[model samples]
Target chain A: MTTFFSVAYYTFIENIRKKIFYGLILFGGVMMGASVLLSVLGGQQTLRILLDLGSSAIEFFALLGVGFSAVTLILEEMESKTIYLILTRPVSRFHYLTGRYAGLLMALYAGMLAMALMHVSLLLFNGWVFHARYVLSLFLSAEKILVVGSVALFFSLFSSSAVSSLSFTVFFWILGHFSGEINYLGTQIPSLAGKLAIGIFYYVIPNMQYFNLRDFWDVPQVMGNWVWLSFAYGCAYSAVFILLTVMLFKRKEF
Target chain B: MLRLLVISVVLFSVVNAELARGFAYPLAFSAADAAASYTGLDIASVVMGVRKLGADIAWIQLLQYYGTPEKPLDEDRAFQLSWDMTKYLFGAKIDKEVCFTAGCDDKSHYHPQIDGGVYPLFLQYCYRIVALDPSYYFTYLYGGGALAWNLNRPQEALLLLEHGIAVLAKYQHASVRDIHEPYWQLNLYVSAIVYRKSGDFTGMLSLLETAVGQPDAPNMIKGILANIYQKQKKYTEALRLWINIYDTNDLSYRRRAEEKVNELKKIICINPDFSIA
Candidate 1:
């Protein structure tokens, strides 16, 4: 456990030093600030636009940060022969992989937190009434980013190239948000094989709709047991991908 | 590796199913109903789970379309002073002065021909907007009110309101037996439009009064009710509504409200206690 946390700390420090990390954080802040201009066109819904657009900018930039970092975490190490140096020490592959993932998540979430702070400040400047759901929405967004990072890491291990891993992760991201449509299609299709195929796709992809709490946070009676279930689902999905990533890493020649 | 892969797949399927059973969203991604220009946006918003942002874009587009001066149908007379252009440039104050200087009577100035024209694509814009984000209550209110009163198309307004109510029903709690505020507000708009369609002016006026009294009622509704009171010669009531609209500080209505309040005050000074029903 000590080794795991040490590896995590090292990875976190190293990843934050990259220029792209700082660029993403800067871009997120600029995006939240730009929302003020966009909200002008919303007429009476200026505050709503500010709140929605700012939160979306935070989530989107965090997803991009996680995707870039996760897909490159292992591939860059292998390319630079850094994995051998780490493996030569008294550290197991499980600890190293989990630690690297934890560190990647830490850096991405730190960036998200900075963006969220800017968003909150902007909202307050615009006379936005504070709601507890704002925190819940940010928390759910972090969980969604975590799932994406784990999936990207798994793809990096299973695929041959970082480009392919990134492409697969993005494809899955789109499919995940479309899971509701896939479920609807499963019921609408008449053929048995088509239904089976749609069913498989539905279950295989992560359902991003489950984490889209920001869209309906104001709705009454909608956040009962479902919120907890969605959280559990995010954790279980990430764990499955992480475990698979470990299995793939164990078989590598390096 | 193969055994672990199988285990991962099984675990993923089980967890996903459990969440799927308990979770329900009020989204129905239907590209069939959207305008051709907005179909791509509608699909992208649903696929990317950014429906609210897409709706905002559509809302802004609608505002721009309605806010712009309508083009003249006759090519040769296009540059001449179109009524909409006159209204856009001078607003109510200068437009009224221009009409009076041109020897126009009060009836002709106040009641422009309802059948002179309508915005052809207003209902289509409303449909495209709500199709992207059905929970956008303002679209329903603004679109319905504009259609029924401004465009003289109460039937179309009722149609839009019905669609809004039906779509919003999906968000209602199953066993709560109580309606949400947006849904109830929409029903109120429907009844007011119904009264308007039947030419029951008193009924429509009373219903609108009730609507504007709600805490969440929009300034647009207040403006509409004030105009109605002004038309009926109820100067005191008109002044009260205009004052309320000015206090809201909504930029879209503030200038017009200020003008109405000043104009109504002058009319009331002549006969301080006089009011017509």
Candidate 2:
């Protein structure tokens, strides 16, 4: 476990060295800045626009960072024979994989922190004190990053870096909003098989909506019973994904 | 003389016809001038642009018809200018009709229901705006919180206000400073209203304190604070603030304060040792 953590920590440091992290941070800052300009468009909803742009930008850039870092971390190391040097030592494949996963997770955590700090600084600068829920959102955001990181790590085992990142990220993004749409569609479709297939898929896929407490936090409303259940679901799904990745990495030739 | 007389009649008929068509801008300007003493861009930049275009077109038509600048100001031209200005400000024919309704009763009823059949069409329109830009706190604040809350749809207001705050939080965390402030204020305001309405006085007090300090804090918020204090039997403080409001520049707040003061004074007179007194 110590070895695993050390490896993960280093991997996270390596990801921070990449250009994409800086790029995403810059992009997010610019989007937020643009909100002031958008306010002149005559509607009294400038803050709303700013909030939407800021949140969407942060979510997008964070997801991008996680996907890019997780995708390339293992595959690049493997393709360049860097993994052999690491693995030729007394370290096991499990340690290597776990280390890499931890590192990516850490990088994602750091990125989210930086982004969150920037937003908070803005609020403080504007003389608006922080709300308690904003702190909870940080935890929730981190949880989301964990889920995102797991998907990318799992997909990287058998696939190319580009494919792994794209596939998993797309899957996460689409599936995040899929449950609600699928449930709505369930009533419209006439065939029983169609409904059954959707039902099966629903169970098979992670219900991303479960992690969404944005509705609760925004409105100062309490999260429903399902929010906690969703956390449990996320943990279970992440665990299974990590286990699968470990097994796949252990069986690989190089 | 006969030829001149015939031409005069023809010009008069043309002018009357144009007046009947509603191009009356001079009349609009005169009416607008009478309404207020203040002078600024009260019509908005977009309306100004439309007015310029209409005026230029009317002038060109007047030049062509009269063949000189010496012709009397055409009533038809004035009507055309007013019609063009109204069109520019209001948009299509249907919009003009809707906007022209005396008290918004005709316009408010046209909203369509979604799956649940809960809200009418206009509410959906406001909801769509929030959906398109969840960060826009004003829509949820004024449109959802103020209007919808007054309309007795607290749930919907809460939902919108929640989403709006989430958007603000997301951006705020993302380092978007501009949205972070207003949204924070809006969140405080909405939550305060909800807490007050739900009779959660302590929670409401906390929110109201935050709200009064916000840049977008309404003048009426002071009244809410006073009421809360009054309910807590802090009559001296409430009365002090209420009296200040009566003496303040915000005329809209004065009447409410006066009424509250009168009612409280009457209560004190009726019951010398009343708990509130």
Candidate 3:
């Protein structure tokens, strides 16, 4: 446990040092500003424009940061033979991988925090500030990020670079956004191939859309039950993905 | 790809056919003629149709908001089309993949929120679309701001404008936000229009004063003061405003100003005292 904490702590620092965190601020910041133009061209749906842009940008940039970092960190350590050195120490491979994953997860959390600040700032600027629910949305967003991070790490067990791992991770992101529709469409399509694709994709993908309570948060119209249900689903999905990542890493050759 | 294209085309045609069949035949020719004379056929007809659809959607959304509606109504077809368009605006990347056409962009500018839905409900829907495509400005600007304002919902309009501005601020940064700063200015103008329609000239003037200085304010707005002055038979002051508009602005509203100038001339023609230096 101590060794895991040490690896996680260092990994968090290393990931933070990269340009990814800055990119998060820059991308999210830019999107918030662009909402003004959206309001203009939007004709009369400005609030919708601002809220949508602010929340969406936060989700996209955070996902990208997590996916890229998870894949790159694991691959780089392996490529540099750093994992071999760590393995020779008293630390077990599970502890090392767990620590690294934990660190990446923390970095993902930091990226989300940076994004949440941007969202809050944008909200304040727009003069539609909400506190309690906004913070909940941020927590949900962070969980969504973890799902992506875990997927990226799982792919990294065999991936050689962040790009390849991200490619797979991107699929998960797409799946997360479209999971509901996929399930809906699965029922409509009669073909075995179509049903199989939809069914398999439904289970395999992260289904991030389930956690997307941005609409609910912005409107604050949804009941507490739905919010709780979404949180439950997100937590369950995150745990499953983390377990999958650990399993893949355990079998990976050093 | 070919199969998908064929399927989409078929679906599109079927949907249009159904819609066409549902239209009131002979089109209430008397009422249609009166409306056409004032607003022109295309704009008039489309607005009336859209307004009706919006009204239905609004009622449904209102019901949904109050928890009165137990089931989604068929009126949601229009809402869903707008929803899909909003989805596309956000980089869903499904526009090309789908066989049927639906979604918002430069072309399909109607925002469901602006049309007729309950304010909060529509806000949630619009937020989803904007989230997907923060760059698509029309959803927030025209849909939320202008339409809602015209519909006599200023509070909702303010909310929409604020959100839209924030999104643009984030993506485009302060510089681009400045470029589109006229939009924020226009919101004030719309407020003036709203007040003017409500017979609150004092409030209108106050809003217009703020609006005219905005980077994007049209010259016509400045001329509006002159027109208002002319209404009061304050021809000389009106003339000065008309001249200011004529001297400073470009051609965008030249014709409208020309008509206003002619109107001012008629006022002076009736009373020699109306002439200004």
Number of backbone clashes in candidate 1: 0
Tens digits of per-residue lDDT for model 2, B1-277: 2354355445434433332232111112322123222213223211221222122222222222222223244898556544543343233232222122124555333211111123333344444434322433444555454333334566666665665565556445334345556766766767766876687878978776666555455444566577768788877667656665565433334444665666666655655443321
Chain B TM, every candidate: 0.75, 0.40, 0.35
User: Can you give the lDDT of residue B196 in candidate 2?
Assistant: 60
iRMSD for each candidate structure, in the order shown: 2.6, 31.4, 19.8
Predicted structure with the largest lDDT when compared to the true one: 1
- Once superposed on the true structure, which residue ranges of model 1 sit more than 4 Å away at CA? B1-11, B30-37, B72-117, B173-178, B265-277
Give the alpha-carbon lDDT of every model: 0.79, 0.55, 0.56
Tell me how large the interface RMSD of candidate 2 is.
31.4
Sorting all predicted structures by DockQ, with the top scorer first, yields: 1, 3, 2
TM-score of each: 0.86, 0.52, 0.50
Q: What are the per-residue Cα lDDT tens digits for candidate 1 across B1-277?
A: 4676577667667767777777777565555455425667767876777777777878878876776546434754343335544443333343432221123455434222323347888999898888777777888898898898878899989989999887767666542533477788899999999888888988998889998888667777787788778888998898999888777655555556766776787788965553322
Question: Which candidate tops DockQ?
Answer: 1
Give stretches of model 2 more than 4 Å off.
Answer: A39-49, A186-192, A224-226, B1-124, B130-277
Which residue pairs in candidate 1 collide?
Answer: none
